[model samples]
Target: MVEADTTLAQVLRSNLMLTGTKIGCNEGQCGACSVLIDGKVVRSCAMKMRRIKDGATITTIEGIGTPEDLHPLQVAWIVHGGAQCGFCTPGFIVSAKGLLDSNPSPSREDVRNWFSRHRNACRCTGYKQLVDATLDAAKVLRGEMSIEQLQFMIPEDGRIWGTKYPRPSALAKVTGTCDYGADLGLQLPEDTLQLALVQAEVSHAHIKSIDTAEAGLMPGVYKILAHKDIKGKNRITGLITFPTNKGDGWDRPILCDEKVFQFGDAIEIHPGPPNVYFKQRVAKGEETEPLFAAAG
Candidate 1:
């Protein structure tokens, strides 16, 4: 019954030791830590360990297939140049697995949409190769082509058209024996600490002041930190600023300075049990109310 709030990424890397799941951006925007949770793909970095405490099954790259028994998707990736550098391979493989699991015979458009919107592959391999690879893998999985036939399909010119050889992990991946980073149910001691960001209440407002007295005194609340508490470099890299229709300059803050330029900017850090902090934020209030309320 070990249960403490923890980051999914930390659990995967430290406890599961499945380093194949790369951590591109700690934020959920990047698909680097993408893994299937209960058969649905989710970004691990945004997922809190406490959210899945009921023992939901998780699947990471390791769970899909192995070098000896590669999944069809793996085989196609190699044959079609769907992978290069390989940092994003695990994510792509997992996503492709999800797509194939639901729709074993996906159309070209399906493959394009699945990869384009969900898995953010920045490698510039382009979708044409990926789509072709997925289709090829689907054919192989359906037993429409033999491994030997696939081998002869490869062109001698070294183009990403055809190749043969069973993906080493294909059998294991289809059998559901492979373990991905997300498959790990890393248990945390009951006393492990957790943290959540406390966003600002108003857009384009300065830090008039923060009243953490009541929150700090609340049960299970450990600490409340502001921008001043940031020890390391405060700015974010690779930032892009653009203009909005309102003619207002839309300059996003990689890390919020004292002034908040947007509505959902993170303003503070509330360290404690993850559940407790999240619940507090979800609670309805003037300053702490959610930006969007569900309709009845």
Candidate 2:
């Protein structure tokens, strides 16, 4: 059972343990959480459980294929270098599946038009590789090309460079089985308490005061640990050295108690110019500064 206010993406990830449906830009701007809803691609993040009709079918990346019996699109994605960084790969594949399902004989321009209309964006590898892979997958689906022909084989010369080899994690990524940071975090023990930082909102400001009383009363909030609750060194040991060979003392703090230098900053920088206390003097024979000449 899902909460009425919970998003479909949240339900899929938290309740159903379908981490393949990423929760990116939950406002529906990024298509990372895309899934097929009733045979049409829909942003899962923007869709709430309350809005879903009964018995409506949904298909995520996991439903598309498996590692052993991979879909043609997944195979093409690997061989054609369609996935890089891999975060956006699932969305692209799901969206592509929707397009291919609707129009299996789509032209190259049609593929481009489909992606543009769906707003399936990929940041790592350019769209050329993705389009190429989609077109090739379409051919395979049409029985014009065999999957074996598209599979990569090692060169006879034993040289792997400049050859098309699938990325080591490509299968996991394209299949939506790869565990990203957020995905791994979900596997932690139920007793694990999540930490959220109370970051500064302004670029620079003096912290007049902080009141955690109201927030502490909120249910499910275990504790609001302030800087004062810290046990040992409240700052990170500053190892940075100046040109004069002096170590910067306590410059990098673990928590800011007094002031903030920038937004989301936990450490406060010392006021004034950066660590270099003295101006560098260029040494020329006799044209150098009197201090440098005298030192020589």
Candidate 3:
């Protein structure tokens, strides 16, 4: 029960820890805080407790479904890619549920018309995927189709996952707006060090000597990490997941202190600018490469 002047959104989010009821543009302008009150969707942020009747039951995001047993709309959201960044997903789902309960057979235009009255805001995904998800979920609710039938109902040959449903990011990839790991460098702090790969030239070797006295003076190179710098056990441990190989996982190196081990085992790593410019800056590495054939 809420106080007389308290908005349902305030009590649900701040007090009850229901952060799914997002608070956005809090003047009933954006319906991100929409909740079901007596089976009708109302913007919880704008509707005060005084307006709600005493006996009216409220249904929140938690009421509809849980993480264990997700609502069909929630499932449809992921399968259909209705949620991107997912700030407005809860409100959209609650509103769609309310719409389906009242009219299960809503047409495409019916979906468009209903959303025109009940406001919701999504900055990331354009409303096309939202409409697709709602309509798809409506099909399930109306008993015309099953959720799994819509999702992974491939031929019984069992060779494929789905019938080539394009991912939601396909358009974004084509438009060149999709963010990649290297692209995120712009968002990182200016002082953050970027790691660039510097491969050891030797193919097979025991690392007898290393000369980095001049390489340390290179521009933009903050520091270098080698096997000597490691403070703990060199080999990674504790990942034996089977009964047969329970305690035998000491077969790798953090850094090859005396041996190169393989063709691509990581050797000396330096923290510097992630570019070819940093490559030219390092001093020449002169070392002995000893080759020995493995004997079974």
Candidate 4:
């Protein structure tokens, strides 16, 4: 059973108990959930668990390195103050690992671009420190530094734990022993249903009439929630102000009613074999539209 519309952050957090993968935005815009899928850094928030269920191997911060046998990147992160608030550290570490794994020796500009996709950060540290740390760690990983020399680089004050020049988790991270949120066994109930939002195609248009009769009759669709189906509150949580002047903002139901707020706004929730729904959407060319829009 593949899971669809399942955020990798949630999979890492709730299922695997890998609290390291922080859920910054719960949206793909933030790189907090960045992880390595087949050695490429990807945003976990936007990735559907079902899409990767077949054969893709995921690498989380934990998978990259560990405290006992840290990857060089982890060491760099600690010695260089690349981590602060520690929320975004895991994702950054994993991303850096992916970059270094491919490039081994990256320039400053390369480092910046490697992290270009990540917009979130901690107040304590800046990108320069992270870049410097990564460079140093790369030197160590590439066998440029001897263990004794690496140890000598440590400060006498011992302010940092892994600052002795080598990251404690570097080896573990590179070896793929560390585990993160998504690695845990989700083990959801057999009957537990998965859902995905089907949004409106038009932007800035009031919905005239919705034709759900055909969709509702589909084989595996459990329920089609409309604005009227909401019993409690319809507003989206975490919003400070209602911009649309639409009821409490929560007034928007789980599904759009007569008013469609924006293009790609959820109009329907599909529950069934995730692969089937995904295939159907792809077959209808909905999947390719976004790519074309982005390219244009």
- Which lDDT values do the candidates have, in the order given? 0.66, 0.78, 0.69, 0.66
**Ranking of all predicted structures according to lDDT, beginning with the best and ending with the worst:** 2, 3, 1, 4
**Cα deviation in Å at residue 20, candidate 3?**
1.5
Worst 10 residues of 3 by lDDT: 287-296
lDDT score at residue 294, model 1, on the 0-100 scale: 30
Worst 10 residues of 2 by lDDT: 271-280
| Index of the highest-TM-score prediction | 2
TM-score of 1: 0.52
What TM-score would candidate 2 get against the native? 0.76
Model 4 per-residue lDDT tens digits across residues 80-153: 65654455677778888888899998998888887885554545566787788778878888899743443336
Which of the predicted structures, 2 or 4, would earn the higher TM-score when compared with the native?
2
Which residue pairs of candidate 2 clash? none
**CA shift at 238, candidate 3, in angstroms?**
41
Per-residue lDDT tens digits of candidate 2, residues 217-267? 545666567777777877666555455635456654577777786788753
The 10-residue segment with the lowest total lDDT in model 1? 286-295
How well does each candidate superpose onto the true structure, as a TM-score? 0.52, 0.76, 0.52, 0.52
Instruction: Tell me, by lDDT, which candidate is best.
Output: 2
- Model 1 over residues 1-296: C-alpha lDDT tens digits? 21244567656765556666767776777687788899988888777766874778889888887766667777677666666545667777888888888899999999888877775564656667668878888898889986555442536676653445335553433333344543432245545667667776777887667676877786787887865676765654323334433433333444476578777788777678745754665674311222222322
Runs in model 3 with CA error above 4 Å? 152-296
Cα misplacement distance, residue 11 of candidate 1 (Å): 0.5
